[model samples]
Target: MRSLTGPTVETIIGVVVRLLADERGESEADVRDELAEGGWELPIDSLRLVEILVQLEQELGVEVPADVESARSMRSVRAFAEVVLAACTTSDGSPSS
Candidate 1:
């Protein structure tokens, strides 16, 4: 396993921004700004969200749960990050910093 340090909210947001930009064919700056203004509700469709989650799982090496709770977490970027961070912490047996 990788020596995983828990990912920060900013890191998760950065990844999400990049993924959204790539998926939507937009610039990262535009996506970032939109997400900043939108806050809790992500601007993408469920399909895009799933694609991003798959990418996040690949990039971060964490298995994001596919249950209802996980779906609820996807309501916001920070919430989603918390879920990923929790997974990382669980896998590495380390407290999230």
Candidate 2:
């Protein structure tokens, strides 16, 4: 697997969070705090997290497993990216590192 880039991950998380915040008329800080409250290291709400994951999977052409429930898979932005990247690498016939 390719090394994770902090900026890339941060950018993705920020975009998703911002979108969710805007849609819900909530402050970004509140969203971040909610994720923290949920014990997520990267900090994001569950619905927004699922939306971001679905978007990422579509954009990246990655096939994330459907078996993992929404709560488990969308725990944090970092975890979401990790799972997507890993699933992409394996599902697209790329050699896994």
Candidate 3:
């Protein structure tokens, strides 16, 4: 839910990876590679996924209510981005949905 603005998709992925590394106490590079291997190209659900979500809410000052919709939307990096960007932006972070 954080208001993250950036240029590259990799940069956004990197930010999420860094947060996972910090909270999960795992090697950042390892997490990054794991995410990449999982076809995520980023860490979406390392050990600290919930912590990262809480941090996002705190950082953004937005409440992403816990529910089935939120759960389904956070199943991957791009999905999470779409949800967060929708919560933070008007355009849903895509040209079409």
Candidate 4:
């Protein structure tokens, strides 16, 4: 396993922003607007959302419950970050049975 760095909200945001930018072939500045302009829902598709979550889980070594109800409520970047931060806060980075 790679040395686990404690995942913080900001850390997750930075990673998500970078990954979103990479996936979209855009700049971080482009992706960071949702955050800078306050919490508006991210205008992204299902495929891109999965890509971001999957990569985030891999990078953080955490398995967010696949069926989280609040996930559906994640309409924006801040919402997404809040969901992720809540997940990380609630668990110890282990697979759920």
What is candidate 4's lDDT per residue for 6-87, written digit by digit as tens? Answer: 5666777787788888888999998788557765566678878887888887877666676655576457676676677667
- Per-residue lDDT over 1-97 for candidate 3, one digit per residue giving the tens place of the 0 to 100 score: 4455532335445666777788768999988788778987444444467788777656654466666776776667766655655554433344322
What TM-score would you give candidate 3 relative to the actual structure?
0.63
The segments of candidate 1 whose C-alpha lies over 4 angstroms from its true place after superposition are: 1-4
RMSD of every prediction? 2.2, 5.5, 4.8, 4.3
Model 1, residue 29: distance off in Å is: 1.1
* Local lDDT at 64 for model 2: 75
TM-score for all models, in order of appearance: 0.86, 0.50, 0.63, 0.74
* Model 3 residue 97 distance off true place after TM-score fit, in angstroms: 16
Model 3 alpha-carbon drift over 4 Å, by segment? 1-12, 41-47, 90-97
**Model 1 weakest lDDT span, ten residues long:** 1-10
Which ten-residue region of model 3 has the weakest summed lDDT?
88-97
- By lDDT, the better pick of 1 and 3 is 1
Error of 2 at 2 (Å): 17
If both were scored by TM-score, which would come out higher, candidate 1 or candidate 4?
1
The full ranking of all candidates by TM-score, starting with the best, is 1, 4, 3, 2
Which parts of model 4 are misplaced by more than 4 Å? Answer: 1-4, 34-38, 93-97
Better of 2 and 4 by TM-score: 4
Residue 45 lDDT (model 4): 87
The number of the candidate with the highest TM-score is: 1
